[model samples]
Target: MPLADWLDRRTGWRSLAARARADLSRPVPRHVNALFALGTVAGTFLAVQVATGVLLLFHYRASADAAHGSLEALLSEVPSGWFVRSLHAWGAHLFVATLLLHMARVFVYGGYKRPRELTWILGSVLLLLGLGFAFTGSVLPWDQRAYWATTVGTRMAEAAPLVGEELLRLVRGGEEVGEATLGRMFALHVAVLPLALLPVLGAHLWLVRRLGVSTLEDADVEERVGHARLCEGGEPFFPHHVLQEAFVANLALGLLFLLAILAPAGLGPRADPLETPPGVRPEWYFLPVYQLQKYMPRSLLGIEGNTLGFLASIPPVLLLLALPFLDRSPARAPSRRKGAMALGLLVLGLGGALGVLGYLSNRTVQAFGRTFVFDDRGFPERAAGPATEPR
Candidate 1:
């Protein structure tokens, strides 16, 4: 306590403390609900990822030859190493999921309408960075699923319009996915992506702080400005908002630990170059595109079908980025903006459907009283067997 007094007197930490207190004590809209705490939940997961990653780094071997073995050792011999890795694994999924839900809430509530366009954009970028973190981190396991997934995943980049080959080479560090590819992914998962994520995340939080909570997305220009100003009526963020954030964050962390303990991350057999296993699927989030690519005809007007499929995905991403400008209506209510709401539903529904199709691809199954054979492209054809009752 005496050292704290001396440091504060000499180094002026009290001034910084005052600023922090001022920021925390600022008035925010009273209507800010649990949905508002999604950002805080995401921030909590980011901290967990960093903490767990540092622990993994101490035991992880970057080379392809040793990476899988190192993980095996960490899981079996190291204390609670499996739990730490599983936490990181499952946390990545939850982190991206919360970001998506957060963005979706903003979209539905029209939080991106006015004066907060930059915040939405920054949040979108953070979501992209979060995906990069997942993709690269998944590859670090260097096991069968990771190996083939990376192999196909990197090759899928060759579907890009013009610089496809260059992109492939750049990511692979050569013509194929091997040790060099593993090294590059390790760098991205550990260092490059994290560095890029922090600044954008900081700016997004700063904008939210300065603008206060955009409570009434349905409010028009004047009411919107007033709420942003924290004028007339609102509640202080210190105890009220902070307490809500803590509660939601505790639930999120509890769920994360539960998932980690219940279903720890799995490491399959070592990657085999000679034998490419059947029924290999990419991560869940990438399933839509994976299914889309499968449905693509081998050649679409002489251009590769997968290339066309890859190009098709660009429009949706651009739409998300330009949503604020496109939906320029003054009213923020979902009912007031039918077209945007319908389009959002269509996108989400299509993505879910495609993910389902991707999961069922390359397999045969019975459903709806008929036995259907699903091709690698997920096309269902009638089988020879008799129909069965729907379960």
Candidate 2:
């Protein structure tokens, strides 16, 4: 108590605490429930990732020759190193998942309209950056999956119209995914991307603070000069809202540890440039796009399939970036925005279906008391009987 008093006298701890409490006590919409705390959940996972990543970095090697071995050493030779590494790996996937869910929640509420436009833009950028983190982090291990997945990803990059080759070379840091490529991915994963994300995240939070949380009642409406729509007749955010966020955060943390303990991240064989593994694939998030490519012809209407796919994706992305501007309906209710919601649902449903098929590629699976074989293109044919399990 004496030390606490002295510290408070010297550092103004009491004032700081008071200020924090006051800031957090601001009123938020009564409807801002635990579902609205997904962004906070995402931020928590990002913190977990950064902390665990720093611990892993102490033992990690960035070169192709030593990278996989270093990870093995970390898992086997170091104290609680497996926990740290597992948390880092598991946290990355959870981070991406939470970010996607947060975006979906925002979409459902039409949280991208009007004055929150810039916030939505920053969020979209954060989504891409999150995916970048996943890809580059995957390549850091320099294991079989990492190597082959990176190879697939880089080859896919070559589908870009004019700058494809240049982008591929830049990404790989050379002609192929060798030591230089590993080094580049390491730098991007640990340094460049983190630095990029921090500022964007800061700006995003600042915008959230400046504008306050968007509620269902005001998303697509024009801002009025004197009206305070954000917090009108709302509940205090400190106890009511913060408690919900804390609860969700704890649940998410529990899930992360459960996953780490039950199924820790494992490395495959060290990367072999001479050997290509069977059934190599990218992460689940990219599976839909990759699986779509498998179903398409090599060339379509005088255009390469890859190039056409790349071209087709640009319009959606452009449209997404310009959504707040384009969808100016002045109505946020889902019923009024039926067409937009329907389109979004269709895309999400299709992507989920494709991702499921991608995971079952050319393999026989049993479900609902039946067996079916999925082709490389993800189409299913009825199996003769239940497939035998491989030893």
Candidate 3:
């Protein structure tokens, strides 16, 4: 009776291990394709983000006055801090990309039907929380880019019709983006949002296990006969599906590392409320919405375009949440579900188009082998120089 063996038997350690092993070894649909691997890729980067974020918090200062200085110091003075920070930054991009792909896969494969509706709802919530992480993280550096980007970004919330003003105040922590705002964003990035994400993520994963993977071959049949009858045979989750997931995870990490090293995250000048950057852009993922707000006519039907756009954005989210109910057709085949497929395509196309337009609308100008930024109104502004504290 070794001490380790005694503990394993006395505690639930052995049974817990057995149960986990069994869970991983559960059967998966034979038609579960490579797209399913996107979930693993997203989860991998999420773990990286959390790990690097914790390391960063060791040196981070969350105040508006000190936040940019702290980041500059972290890059210059702390050993390996630059690389870790770069990993975390790039991991955010990778996580968002993979998560989108995962959701698209689920949508295209008709995986969000019947008993799995709650799983889809939970995942949709995670998507919004993921974007929250991106928005809050963008403001943490407290640099010129961060300050103006956040200032402009939060302004969109002020278009929420009746509650817009209150929403803007709630987000900014006051009348403007300053000390109070920085504190709120920092708390959200490091504590509040992460705490909220954990339980929802756990429930999503548990639902996947409880219901099993959806199959394409019998989608049409299952829609009518129910998913239980379609689960006739498949491969085990371990070794087979897990190996594919492992491969995708490794590929995602490799790409993240390459980007981190080649184009490491750079800190910019500290935020100055008195000065505005020439061209401030929100993170790429938010570019579509930003572009829409920027280019859309100021007035639509005598209403403010910003308010109209803000209200318009609400329906798509509601539509996604209501997808399982709306798409009640008992056929999962793409050809059979023409309306759903068409709508998915339109959404995807519009997002891609808006992203391109956002990039094109940026007012970056080149001169003397150096790039200079300008305000959206085309006024000349100072360049955000190298990642170093000014003497």
RMSD of each: 2.6, 2.6, 5.5
Better of 2 and 3 by TM-score: 2
Clashing pairs in 3: 278-374, 278-375, 279-374
Ten-residue region with minimum lDDT total, candidate 1: 224-233
> What is the TM-score of each predicted model, taking all chains together?
0.93, 0.92, 0.89
Instruction: Estimate the overall C-alpha local distance difference test score of candidate 3.
Output: 0.84
Q: Give the candidate number with the greatest TM-score.
A: 1
Ranking by lDDT: 1, 2, 3
Score each candidate by Cα lDDT: 0.87, 0.85, 0.84
- Candidate 3: where is the Cα deviation over 4 Å? 217-220, 223-233, 300-302, 364-391
Please give, for residues 115-230, the per-residue lDDT of candidate 3 as tens digits.
67899999989889999999999899898999999999999989988899999999999999999999999999889999999999999988888877886754456667755556
lDDT of 2: 0.85
Query: Where is the poorest 10-residue window by lDDT in model 2?
Result: 219-228
